[model samples]
Target: MKVLQNYIKATNTHNFEEVRKSLHPNAVYFFSDQTCTTHEEIQAYFENGWSIVQEESYQAKNVNWLYSGSDSATCTYTYFYEGYIDGKTISGRGRATNIFVKESDEWLLIHEHLSPLPK
Candidate 1:
């Protein structure tokens, strides 16, 4: 849970380096539009989003931990994001699932999948 919180905080920083610290070396991310299997790709995707959504803020709500063990954990949550795009404030909500694994006593995000809520 702490790792997830830290990851969200890192994302809010809008600094790829900070976000990278929370991700596993072989992390995979499934976004609404694309999938990133490598850290380089993930960083690019994040940076592009940050550029498009200026002053973006993201948060997770109603987090439910599906499983948790000494080595791994999985959770699902409703995610909300708000920011200025094209000088207009915009916001959206979606669903997210995250998988984390403990390595060297540190929890690192191994996988994440995000999708928009139903119309």
Candidate 2:
């Protein structure tokens, strides 16, 4: 979905509002480092620590819709993350999965799980 692509872009750019536009009213964002679940908390976290410094390379490995029901869909994808931050090049590869629900015929993200690459 185009909206899903936009969401990914918004996340890479750290565009919180654009990201918010694609989220459900009651959305849950889960980070690998933090084991908490709350919209406001994650929003604050994003505001504080989410940023793409420079030379960031993000490529989607694959996207597959698991179950596309009349009112919802679940999608899973792998992302390759390589970038530079604070004058040091860093690489982070991970898998991201999300659940998108239709609200009044418009898709909105209801849940997300982002897991980091294994060492």
The prediction achieving the highest TM-score against the true structure is: 1
State the C-alpha lDDT per candidate. Answer: 0.97, 0.76
Residue 98's lDDT in candidate 2:
84
- The candidate that wins on lDDT is 1
Q: List runs of model 2 lying over 4 Å from the truth.
A: 51-58, 117-119
Which residue pairs in candidate 2 have backbone atoms (N, alpha carbon, C) closer than 3 angstroms, thus clashing? none
TM-score of 1: 0.98
**Collision count of model 2:** 0
Candidate 2 lDDT score at position 104: 91
lDDT by residue for model 2 over 6-93, one digit each (tens)? Answer: 7778777665787778888888877787743666776777766556446565666688888888888888888777777887988767
Tens digit of per-residue lDDT, candidate 1, span 1-119: 79899999999999999999999999999999999999999999999999999999999999999999999999999999999999999999999999999999999999999999878
TM-score of each: 0.98, 0.81
